[model samples]
Target: MEEYKKRIIKAIQYIDNNLDAELSLEKVAEIAAYSPFHFHRIFRLIVGETLQNYIIRKRIEKSAFYLALRKNLSIKDIYHQFGFSNHSGFNKTFKKYYGKSPSEFRKLAPENFHKIQAKQSKNGQIDTVFDQYICNIENLLNWTNMHLKIKVTALPEMNLAAVMSLGIANVESSFNTLVDWAKTENLFPGENVKMISVYHDSFKVTPPDKVRIHACMLLDEPLKRQQGEVFPEIIEAGKFIIGSGEVTLSDFEQCWVSLFLWMKENNYSVRKAFPFEIYHTNFKEHPEGKMAVDFCIPIN
Candidate 1:
């Protein structure tokens, strides 16, 4: 990755880890090693939103996560945890984006946890990934054909050369670029190179418009950046329930819905962390033009 993207990601990670705290633009910019003015423009260009907006959205989303999953937490606990000044302000913002008050959303969310019907209004849009995933998951529960060999296991740590893109539409193009860069660098020391799409946000909770997809190639070891938008990132080892099977492109959403259903049935709680898809064989290379993939979901 270029120096700028690397720095921006550093800043973003910091923000994500500290959403409850006050995030001054100057401090965030300093973390990115850029001036506030320069950082503001770059953040908007790359992340598709102003720094403050990003922070606020993350805070609201985090609050929603607590409200939906951590029922032990009260409304005040959720809002205060995210640094809201008062219940009124939090309610105002939550209603704007979710098209419903926090209390009402909480009441409706239990029957369909991770299936909240956030508004798609352009004036108050959900993140792009959330929208795409919502469309993918229409009638998801009705899907009973999903099947695969799935179990929780430890995934070994991996270091990858990654390229990020927004939306599902652009993922293929970005991944192709990363693949070309990796091949040119002769970094494929082993026959098997892991192709991964690392998801930063869960669609179930996040509103649509901004979806982060990092197309990555597993590297044997870290190598200096030579070219392209490739940057280094580490996926820590964790317990993830993985379902492996062949899925047609059209059935992709069904597969995920089925996996989540299975996870719920087996008494696994989803965590706020990265989940991923591992491609065993290229879809284009498959005999039936299907992707031999492993759908992995993080669990607590």
Candidate 2:
């Protein structure tokens, strides 16, 4: 990868991880080891949005998630948690995109969960998490009803060799590239190898066409040297809520939805880490083309 592209992606990872905190462009640029003007330009060029706009939209999107799913927090608490300066400013911005004030949005969340509506806003991402969450969750819920098992456990950290794939359209190609590169380095599958897709952005809050993922091969052997677009990433050891089973290609998204629903139903809280999918069986090689996959979400 170009050094600049890598830097911007690193900066975005930092930005997304700290969405609930104050994010000044100067500080973010500094973290990326670039001057503010240079960082700002590159960020917009690569991410397709101004830094300020991205931060605000991300904050709003996360706050909306909290509002809809986290019932314990008051409206004031949600706004403050997301770094809004004042109640009025948050209300104005939220209403412009969601067409509902914070409280009104909270009130409609449950109803929206049951009956999803696709309402677009100026922002490329859908204005609310409910639209995406509801769409996926309902399908999973209906198919399995109360039968799906969600397991909460602490897992050891994993090292991954990966390549960045932007947009869902390119994920398969990226995975193929990752496997080919891994083979060249003598880093191909061992007795047990996991194929993972680490999601860097939430599909509920990001536009479908622009979602980012790292197509990864779990390292059974330590890689001697790593660099470039195909690189190494560590999925930190932590408590995760895992839902695993044999699923078809279309069942993948549905299973993720079911996991989130399980989280909400059990009153579990999510943490800051990225969620990942681990594939045990390559669907392409299966007789019925089904994969034994695990959908995991980090939790507090």
Clash totals for all candidate models: 9, 1
Model 1: runs farther than 4 Å from truth?
A: 1-6, 70-77, 122-146, 188-190, 222-228
Per-residue lDDT of 1-300 in model 1, one digit per residue for the tens?
A: 357766787788789788778899999999999999999999888777899989988888777766766666799988988889899999999876676688987886654654454556556564212223343333554453344677799888888888876556678988987877877788653478779888875556564456667888887887465354777877787889898888777766667667776776677776667778888777787788898888888777
Deviation from truth (RMSD, Å), model 2: 3.8
Best by lDDT: 2
Single out the weakest 10-residue window by summed lDDT for candidate 1. Answer: 127-136
Give me the overall lDDT of model 1: 0.75
Error of 2 at 269 (Å): 3.3
* Every model's TM-score: 0.82, 0.80
For 265-297, candidate 2 gives per-residue lDDT tens digits of 778877767899998888889999888888899
